[model samples]
Target: MPDQDLTVAVTGPTGDLGIALVDALERSRAVKKIVGMARRPFDPASEGWKKTEYRQGDVLDKASVKDALKGADVVIHLAFSVLGAGDKTREINVEGSRNVFDQAVRSRARRICYASSVAAYGYRSENPKWLTEEVPALGTDQHFYSQQKAEVEQVLAKTLERKKATQAYVFRPCIVSGPRATMLIEEIPYVQLSERMPDAVRSLLGLMPILKPVIPDPGTPFQLVHEDDVASAFVSGVRGVGEPGAYNLAGAGTLTMSDIADAIGWYSIPVPDLAVNATAEVISRVPAAPEKLTWVEAVRNPVLMKTARAKKELRWKPKYSGRQTLRALIDAWKREGPEH
Candidate 1:
C-alpha cells in the first residue's frame, strides 16, 4: 500500500538528485515531513521546501545517522563518492551505506530507496547488450565506483533480508543528465588532464577547440537518462508503488560517443578498439593510478540497461529522451560553461 502523510529521511539531500527529490517530496501530499542529513549545513527553505528539516551529519557517523533518522517512515540513501578511490572513499561507500541501511532497519522504516548505478552491472566484455534486473550485479574490478555500488547493494540486500520488516527498492540509473547536474559534462574537456588539475584551467581548455581534449569514440552506443526521471523512480519507491526489488531506469534511444563530441563543439574522433583496449589494459595494471583512469575501461565496454521492468511494474516513464536530455545540457552549457 502507498503510505501517506509520512516522514521521509534522506541522506545526501543537497546533491543533484537529492535537490530534485526534495522538491518532489515537498510537493507530495503523501509526504508530511522530510528529515535531511548532510555533512554541511543547509536550509531547505532556501530551496523553497517547507516540509524539510535539515541535520548536519555525515553518513559515516552512526550516531548522527541514527539520531537524524528518528521516527522516519521512509529512508532514501543517496550518499556515495564517485570520483575518488582510497581508504576514506571505500570506507564511506561501504560502511557508510551499511550505517544507513542498519539505521533505516533499526527505525523500522517502511521503505528504503537506494540510488544505484548501471555501473553496478560493470563494464565487462561478458555483459549483455541490454542488462535487466534479473542479471547478476557482479560488478567488474575496473573501477572502485562500480565495485562499491555492488558492495553497497549486497549490504542492503542482507540487511533487508534479516529484518524482513523493512523493504528496499534499488534503482539502477544510467549516466544521468540534466541542466542542473553538469558534473559529468564538466569533465568532458578534461579527459586527458589530471584529476587534480584546477577546474578553471579545464573550463578554459574547453573554450578553445584546438586545446580541447580529444575524446576517443569507438562508436559504442550508451544511454543517458534525465535526472528528473531518476527522481521520479525514487518517488515511486518512497510511495511504495513498486515491489521490493531492483529496477533499471534509462531514457529511450541511445547516443554514441561522437554525439557527445558534437555536443561539446567537436572533440570526438574515431579511435580503434585496439588502442582503447591497450589503454584500459595499461590503466588497469597501475593500481595506484588516479581514479579518472578507472573510467577508461568504460569507453570500450558500455553498460546499457533495459527499463521494461520499471515501466511495467512502477508504471515509470521518462519525460525526456536521451537526445533531449543531452540537448538540454548542451543548451545549458552554452550559458554556464566556459564558452559563456
Candidate 2:
C-alpha cells in the first residue's frame, strides 16, 4: 500500500534532478505535501505544483537545515556544490552535508536518501566482472569531488551509528543524462559537424546514416542512467523498499566512447597519448577540466555495475537504453540549441 499522508522534504528543489523528483512526487497520490527547500523562492507557474511548499534555507547553516527538516517524514538531501576552488568544495560537500545529516537526525526523520556519486568508488583499472552492493569503496585523494563524496558517506554512516533508528539510504548514481542534465557532456568543447564539415563530407563518412552510433572501439565502457530512473530510485529508498544501506544506481547497459560518439551520429578518434598529454598541459594551464581525464578514464574504462539489488528490492528498472539516451540528447540539442 502507498504511504499516504507522507510529507517529504527535498533539498536543492531547483536543481536539475531535484525538479524532476519533485514533479514525480507531486504526481504521486502517496505523498500529501512536498516541502521543497532551496536558496531561491519557488515558481508555481513552472508546472502547477500547488501542493509544493517552498522554503528558503541554506544547508551550510545548521539552524536553517534543522528548520527545513522539521515536520518531514522523509528527507531527500540533494543540495550540493560542484564548482569553485578547493576550499569551497569542502565547505559545501563535506561541512554542508554534515549539517544536513545532523538535522535529519534531530528531526527524527524516518528515512534519509542521499545522492552520492560513483566517483566515491574512485577509478578502477581492472573493471569488476560484476559490480554489486558489497563492492568496497576504493576512494582516492586524487580528486576533490571523489574524496568529498567518500567523506560525506563516512559521516552519514557515523550519524546512523549515533541515531540508530533513522534509516539511511545512499544512491551512488553514474553519469546521469536526461531532459535537464547538468554534466560535462552538455558543456563539452566541440564543434557541430554541420558547422565544421560539409554535408557531403558527413554523408561520405556515413555519419548521417546511422542516426546514432551503437558502440565504438577503444571500448571504454561507461554507464548513464536517465534522471527519471534516479528519482524513482530515491522514491523507492524513501519507501524502505530497496536495499537499506548503499547501492549503485547505474544504467542498465554499458557502451564505449566510440559507441557513444557513433550513437550520436559522430565519430571518435582516440586522443593520442601525446595529444592527451598535451591537452592535459593546456587544460591545466587554462582551467582544470571539470574532471581530469585520468580521473575519468579510471571510472570510464570499465563501469561495471549491477542493478539487481535496486531492481529486486526497489522495483526499479531503467526505461531508456544508452543508445536511446544518446539519440534523445542529440535531438534535444538540435531543437534547444544548447542553452543548457
- Which candidate has the highest TM-score of all? 1
* Highest-scoring model, lDDT: 1
Model 2 spans with C-alpha error above 4 angstroms: 83-85, 126-129, 182-184, 188-218, 263-265, 272-274, 288-301
TM-score of 1: 0.89
Q: Estimate each model's TM-score.
A: 0.89, 0.84
Worst 10 residues of 2 by lDDT: 188-197
For candidate 2, write residues 159-251 as lDDT tens digits.
889677688889988777776664535543222222333344344334444433322134456777777878888877776774588878877
Cα displacement (angstroms), candidate 2, residue 15, comes to: 1.3
Q: Give per-candidate clash totals.
A: 0, 6
lDDT of 1 by residue, 186-214 (tens): 65322443333344433433433346555
